[model samples]
Target: MRSLVFLVLLGAAFALDDEKIVGGYECKPYSQPWQVSLNSGYHFCGGSLVNENWVVSAAHCYMSRIEVRLGEHNIVITEGSEQFIYSDKVIRHPNYNSWTLDSDIMLIKLSKPATLNQYVQPVSLPTGCATAGTNCSVTGWGNTMSSTADSNKLQCLEIPILSNSNCNNSYPGMITNTMFCAGYLEGGKDSCQKGESLSMDRRNKKEEEGKKEEEEEGEKEEEGKKEEEEEGGKKEEEEEGEKEEEGKKEEEEEGKKEEEEEEEEDKEWKYLMKFEQQS
Candidate 1:
């Protein structure tokens, strides 16, 4: 699963001074329809729409009250596609550990179902595990760099999934199964310190699914070959056993014939001895 770490903003509603996206560019308007801004009075975290009534976000972003803004491209301007809905309930993971950051996920139920449109839709959940080197992207309104101001426009950064071992090398004893890393090891591109929702590109995800299907097909083929080989081996053993039985039968027949001949000779010799004695 792609994990999100959001830096909660406590200041103004449009505070650009907080953590932001690094090495990212402005996303095409409404390209990320699932992306949503989690706000109380001010924007605090980014989230993704999972369904018409639910949004997924970081657990640490939980607040007593939250407003979810969907179809938002520019945070400052009012886009016709934008839909603002108050959260009816917020459910954070029960096992969330603040220190370890494990199970750092939350779900927000919208007070009303979001109207689905071209500019507002839910993202499909991933079905398979994200492998290393899988291409993905993150989107948020965070700053492009530490030295720069936050962007009002939604920014997206392309990144590759990192192996757990490699991520652990960077933060020893900190990586968890609930977390997976994506970004450059050299530190060129990354999501903003403020939360950016990570997502695997649909194309890449399809490719991964394709690869898995091919692997399963290969395994089935291998199993079939093994079955064929085992059957051939059994047939050969049965043939060998039949041949051995036939050879034993032939030897027994020859022994019986020899015994019959010996008995006939004995009978002839005894008759000859009786004729000589009579002479």
Candidate 2:
């Protein structure tokens, strides 16, 4: 349950570079076809369509007054293609921890399937998490600047994926099996602003050859996550030499961390000095 205005944009460049979720540009209509806005009567969190009848979002933004709006660029005006649907079912992950924000995922089941059109489509769930260098795009109707007020259009930016270890540094002891991190290393653009939505999806191609993975069903998905994590682990040591300064703040905290605790934090941050550092 949150709010926002809309943003206007020119052509899009998918290449990754210096940009801000904080310094993001408002998205033009049709540029992002899979984003959805979760309305809790007023403002809302960002979401993505997994299928015609289901949408996924963060559990931390949960509220009772939930509604799903698709093909929406601005909330104030109603366009012909925009479809408003009520949530028939809301399932926060069984293991979702409110305090730690672990497994921050929720599923919204619409009363009926949304009609597929040019403006509305589902984002493909990768067979596994994206690799370290993948440029994942996050879009939302959050604030244009750092402040709480949102714009009239959706905002989007491409952020490279950071490993679990690097992500854990930002949120002490918070990263989990179901979550992967992506944001500016220096803290610029981010879609999780006040009154904004956190809509995101991976742009990687689906693995058609991996259809056999459907056999194990749930078991296979867990394996895929492990594989992705291991793939990123290859360059962990190289990243540790850098990123030492940015972590000093998180390192300082309020009081001293025990020797054992410091040891663990170091273990997690040994990779992902920056999202684009693989080169």
Candidate 3:
């Protein structure tokens, strides 16, 4: 799996300028109803509408003047669904640390409420923290590759939530309770650079319960079949064990490869930082 670092925004903001989607694809238009583009003269960050009059994003994306464009899919062209509204105020987290990117969240109040429509809607706030290994998705208009320009259309990527221990091991002394990491540890996929909101694909509570019940029933049936097969599978089991040993060796090689890729990715980030500073 590819690993990428992400900052979790809880009732706050995030900031990203000139960031793009890496290893993502174009999403269906208007599928992400809560997605919005934060702009001044140009797109700087991505945000999610919490309500008609407020948006959540990265604190570092704050500017003197920001325009929140709702229902925007293809930002390079005007779709009739777009609603451009200016920011009334921006509130960044007081505890935000730019150096370490701790508590990197912000909120923006819209000058006017966005009109509710099929293309413009608010996202439900998560009631609790997502558990490790949960699947989530991120959408944005950031560049698909490091060397490419920003994508005109919205892009989406699915990533898994990493456990806090694994995250700390990857970032080493940088993760906090307020922050969580999601991405592939093997490299090649990430949320551009910053200012992208991570959203969970939540199911209705009743639907989830029903699905769980079905899964339990299926597992019980499978258990009976497995018991029947085990009595006749001794030879196959031995063969499987031999295959597993080979798999372990392959896994060790893959781990070493991932470590090398992580180093390369770090070098790429450093180069990008130097380029940005010179520009």
User: Top model by lDDT, which number?
Assistant: 3
TM-score, one value per model: 0.68, 0.61, 0.70
Off by over 4 Å in 2: 1-20, 193-279
lDDT per residue for candidate 3 within 45-128, as digits (tens), equals 888888899988887787867999999999999889999999999998999887777778888999999998999988888767
- On residues 1-279, what C-alpha lDDT tens digit does candidate 2 reach at each position? 111111111001111121225667777786666678778776556677778998777665566557888888876787777988888988887987766555556777898899889888876654444566455566777556545565668776766667667767766664556555666678665645321233223212334324445656657777888887876674564466456644775676533566667777776666545434764
Ranking by TM-score: 3, 1, 2
Stretches of model 3 off by over 4 angstroms after superposition: 1-18, 204-206, 213-279
Note the Cα lDDT for every prediction shown: 0.76, 0.61, 0.78
Largest TM-score belongs to which candidate?
3
Model 1: per-residue Cα lDDT over 1-279, one tens digit each: 332332221111123245676678999998888889988777778888889999987776778679999999999888788999999999989998766767777889999999999888887787667688877778888876566555789988777788878878877877777777777889777664444577766665467889999999999999999998999998899899899889898899999999999999999999999999999
The lDDT, on a scale of 0 to 1, for candidate 2 is: 0.61
Better of 1 and 2 by TM-score: 1
